[model samples]
Target: MRVLIIGAGGFVGRHLLPNLRDEGMEIIPTGRSPDRLRRLFPGCPVQQCDLSRDRAADWLPRLAGIDAVINLAGLIRDGAGGFDDVHEQGAKALFDACLAAGVRRVIQVSALGADEMGTSAYHRSKKAADDHLASLDPEGGRMDWAVLRPSLVIGRGGASTEMLAALAAAPLPLRLGPGDWRVQPLHVDDLVVIIIRLLHRREPFAGRLDLVGPEPMTTDTLTLTLRRWLGLPPARFLPLPRPLLALGAALGDRFGFGPASRDSLAMLAAGNVGDDSAVRAFLGRPARPLAQALARHPAMAADRWRARLLPLATPIRLLLAAIWIWTGIVSLGLYPVEGSYALLAPLGLTGLSATLALYGGALLDLGLGLALLLRWRPVAIGAAQLALMAVYTALISLYLPDLWLHPFGAISKNLAVAGATLAMMAMEAEHG
Candidate 1:
């Protein structure tokens, strides 16, 4: 079957085309940007025509041989005319063109809650188009349409990831007061499978359908999941007051960021949830778990690792270096381990400092070394080691009264962080 996917250069579209092509079906992909369309699907036919900007009259004739048209094109902006231009107007134009081209089987990629009241303009526009598609039928009355309504389509690419990475990379001290918002993220691969199935079914169309992942998680959990994938410190989400957020939204709008703040908060507030039983039954396979999905994503993981580990290298190196120096002095001047304890103990300075520098710092160094040489979990290992050392320092400072210089150890410890961290990275790179 020939499948014509509009907006075939977007996140979901980019993920979908390869699957369809692998199935050995010819695909005609359309997008707004000619370069993007060509870059995404070089072998498959690509047409550059913005559904909102260009009239369908010029492209409908070219869509002559299209059997099924999947519209993935949509706009995501708040206020004024962005939604109307892309979501509604663009979709309507594409549908009209598909109809003229005699493309009967249309699969509309709609969003959850689009048909519900109080939905955003983006949601409302999708709902309106969905309603229009459901109303159309041939004289014989074969419904000839199916809708794949996905909530929070999560993929390793595109705007959502860029946004998440940007937020994760911020340098300011973050403090969030109890993040409890629940959300679900669907894997683009799973959603694409459902879409492929929907495109071929000849049976009478049912009402709007929904596709979702198998798990639900809190916003805090989501942030942590992203952190683990990136090997970065967990995101510290501070709860901005609603009024402050509103002011931010206003500022963002003024600065031409659209209404990202308002819309994002609205989404976070409502929470994205849906029933997945319907599609799961059809797929005969459970949706990919968010954790598993992230683990399998190396590109996102690499990008995030670069963001997290690279900047902290200098400080970490300095700390590692300080730890070594302090340990070296304590072991050489004060604490002696190998020789007789009678001689070493009477020295009064105690070999504990020297022992810590040689042994404790070595353990720290080797642990850090292994962390860099291997690609297991560097941030996690670093955090654990830091905690342990901090506790050790606190205990010694309290009991011994003379060795309050432990904090200074961390100053030199960070020097080895880079080499060890890189070893781990190299291992991961080679295996991956």
Candidate 2:
């Protein structure tokens, strides 16, 4: 059977594509990035489509000759209010298009806790889409529509899984408040298998079903389990006040680092457990246990190290940026100008020339700090920083060699800083 899979470039899509390909079904994968989709599903028909922004009529032509449409398109959290567009209006458009195209089946991958009175925007939007799709054509029986509302899904490359894994990799013990909230974790592999079975069955399955694991786990237990899976020692954790966490999230949202907003906190507060009988009935067996799933995909040291170190980049960049910005501020007004001139005078910089050099260097430092913090041309910024440090060190060594032996180790410290800058540049180049 030919199928159209929207949002086929996401984490779920990454797993689903390979599995679907193995099933020998003709697949049409569509998403925002045509290049990425092409790479992921080479030799298969791939279409560039954005459900949140594009017109439904535009996607209709592509839907032609497609037997089924599986919408895995969704956003966990969005700062730009794109969730409503993608979840509600986007699903509406796709449903209309599917009906018009006479598509035989449509499967919507929604989340657990999706209801009319959902607490979070993410859940509310998902519920709105589910309701809209469920309201169509029960009497006529024209389309086979199925909605799978799975609880927390765990798999390699999943955003939520990665986040948890990274947290588990932390150097010190990590605490996420009381962590009493419970969730029935579902394996992505299990979910995919169920979908495949449903697709192959002669009888169509209609209505919403919860796809969850056989056992429920509390947040704290889950966290500790993941930590043990990563081969880490027993770590202590302290409960954090919900209000304090919310305050931090609000601040993080403003800075773009914090994707975990109040909505997510709300969702966490409400628990994410569901009945798994439907999933078991479809799978013909009980769902995979959390321990078994974790054991099956044993954690690698390299992955753990990468996860642990990756988060350090932000703080390191900020620290380095702050150093430069502070240096600029001091050079501009805080530090006596006479001392700056005295230091530069040895190198023949005097009068207007010395003033220009001092102020100009300060401005350059300020600009570099801002650029680094903003992540504008990160590779170039890293390269520039290395070059500047090297030049400064050379000039200092040549002009005032005695400073190298000073107690503060001002000139010597540049060696380490330059190395860090070089490492940053190297990392950026390799990753890019």
Candidate 3:
């Protein structure tokens, strides 16, 4: 059967595509970036279509000869489009196009909290699309649709999984607020199995299914489990008050960093527990527990390295930025200009040349520092930082060799900073 998978470039979609292809299904994947999709799933027919930007008319052509549709499109945080556009309008348009094109089945992979009781905009917007799809009826009345509301899906390549694992691997793990917030974490692989079952089943199963794990777990328990999975020893967590977490969420909202936004905080407080009977019956077995699922695939060396190094990536970047920026500020008149020029004069720099070298080097330092801070072309910035450090160290060693033996180890510290920069670059490349 031919299937059209929307948002096929997302984490869940990436997993689902290969599984379906191995099951002998003709897959037509659609995402915002066709080039990326091609790179991700070679030899498969991929289409470039943005649900938020593309309308029903734009989607009609892609729906031709499609036997089934699975919409895994969602956003944790708004970008390029708000929640309403992506979750509501875009989804509605896709459903409409499906009906118009005579597609028989659609499975919407929505979130667990997306219901009438949902408080966050993320949930409410999802509910809107779910309602719209439920309300639609085609001329033949043969349309079969199921809304699968999955809890926190945990598996490799999942953003939430990576984030939680990194947090667990931190030297000092933090217990946010009371640490009582709970979730029924489902394995992404299990979710995929259910979708495949739904697609192949002869009997029509129409309605919503809350796909969740066998048991609910507290956030603390979840993190601890992840930590143990990484083969790390148990750690004492540093407790953080609700106010501090709230402040961090506020900062995350303002700066667009991390996953501590207000909406997520509210959702966490509400919790993500749900009945798993539907999932169990649908799959003909209980879903795998988080610990068991993780244990089945032992954490490889790369996994352990990722868990350990990810948390340190930001701090390393910040430290390097501060070093470069502070040095520039000190050189640009915060310290005596005469001293800077005196340091430069040993290399035959004098008069206007000395002044130019002093100020010009200071400006370059400031620019590199700001680039690191802003995360602009990190690989390039890292290379530049390394090269500049090498040049400075070589010049100092040749002209002012005594400074290397100074009590402060001022010249010696550059080696350590250069090493840090290389580490940061490796992390960036790993992420990309």
Candidate 4:
């Protein structure tokens, strides 16, 4: 059977595509970026389409000759479109196109807690699309639709998993909320299996299915479990008050940094547990627990390193920034101007030339520092900082070699700073 996989470039879609292909199903992947899709699934037919922007008429051509459509498109935070646009309007449009094109089946991958009573905007928007799909006439049109509301989906390369792993790898993980916010993490592999079953089933199944793991675990237990999987010893957690978490969430909202946003916190507080009976009956077996699922694929050396280093990225970046900014401040006025001029004298710089060198170097240091702190073209800025450091070291060695052996080891400290800068750059590239 031919299947159209929407948002096929996502984390879950990446895992699902290969498995479906192995099952002998012809696949056509669609996403906003066709180039990326082609790169991901080489030689596979792909179409460029943005659900948020595309109407039913625009999606009609893509729907032609499609036997089934599986929509995996979703956004944790708003990007280019809001939740309502991507989740509700765009989804409704795609379902309409599916119906108009005589497509018989659709599987919507929605989040748990997506219902009329959903508090978070993410859940509420998802509910809107699920409702629209359920409202469609299945019996009259022979349309078979199933909505899969999965809880926290844990797997390799998943953003949430990566974030949680980083937290677990921290020297002292911060306990967010009251440590009672529970989540039933469904392995991405099981989720894939469930979808395959729904697709291959002969009988029509219309309505929502809460796909969750056999066990529901609290956030603290979840973190400790991840730590154990990573072969790390348990460490005491630093408790964060609700006010602090709220403040961090506000900052995250403003800066778009980590995963501490208001919506996410609210959803966590509400809890994400559900009955696993539906999944068990559908799969003919119980869903794998978190510990068992993680044990199946042991954490590799790279995974362990990634988790450990990811948390340090921000701190290293800030340290580099502080070094540059303070050095600039010292050069500008804090340090005696005469001493700077004296140092420049060794390079044949004097009077106006010496003054310009001092101030110019200070401004350059300040600029690099601010750029590093703000995270503007971070990789590029890091390269620039490295180059500048090299130049400074070379000039200092040629002119004032004695400073290298000074009591403070002024020139020697640059080696450590340079290493830290390189580490920061590597982490940024990996995370991005």
List the candidates' TM-scores in order: 0.65, 0.90, 0.93, 0.90
| Span of 10 residues, lowest total lDDT, candidate 4 | 75-84
Q: What ranges in model 4 sit over 4 Å off?
A: 33-35, 79-81, 138-142, 172-174, 235-237, 351-356
lDDT of 3 by residue, 1-432 (tens): 999999998889998999999999999989888988898999999988887888999989999999999999987776445788989999999999998999989989899989989988889999999988888852225788999999999988787788788878888776757878999999888998999998998876568888899999998998898888888889898777889878977876775556567777788888999999998898888999889988877888788788877668778988889989998998889998888888888999999999998999999999999998887877789999899999999999999999999999999998888889999999877445
Q: How many steric clashes does model 1 contain?
A: 29
What's model 1's TM-score? 0.65
Pairwise TM-score winner, candidates 2 and 3: 3
Better of 3 and 4 by TM-score: 3
- Model 3 score (lDDT): 0.87
- State the local distance difference test value for candidate 2: 0.81
Clashing pairs in 2: none
- Which residue pairs show backbone clashes in model 4? none
* Candidate 2 runs further than 4 Å off: 39-44, 345-348, 377-379, 398-400, 418-432
Candidate 2 accuracy as TM-score? 0.90
For residues 1-432, could you state the per-residue lDDT of candidate 2 as single tens digits?
Answer: 998899998878888878888999999899888887898789888998887876679878988998888999987566687788898888888987888889888899998889765777888888988888878765327888888899888887776776666667786645566777888899888988988876776776578888899988888877777788788887777565787878856865666552356666677778888788998899888898987877888889866775576556667777778888888888998999999999999889999999999999999988998888886776898778878888887888899888899999988888887767766665456334
RMSD in angstroms, all models?
15.0, 2.8, 2.3, 2.6
Ranking by TM-score: 3, 4, 2, 1
lDDT of 4 by residue, 1-432 (tens): 999999999999999999999999999999999988998999899999987899999999998899899999987765445788898999999999988898989999999999877988889889999988988865525789999999999988787888788878888865767777899999998999999988898887798999899989999888888888888888998777888878977877776676667888788888999999988988899898888889988999888998887667788998999999999999999999889999999999999999999999999999999998998878889999999999999999999999999999899999999999999999787534
What stretches of model 3 exceed 4 Å from their correct place? Answer: 79-81, 138-140, 171-173
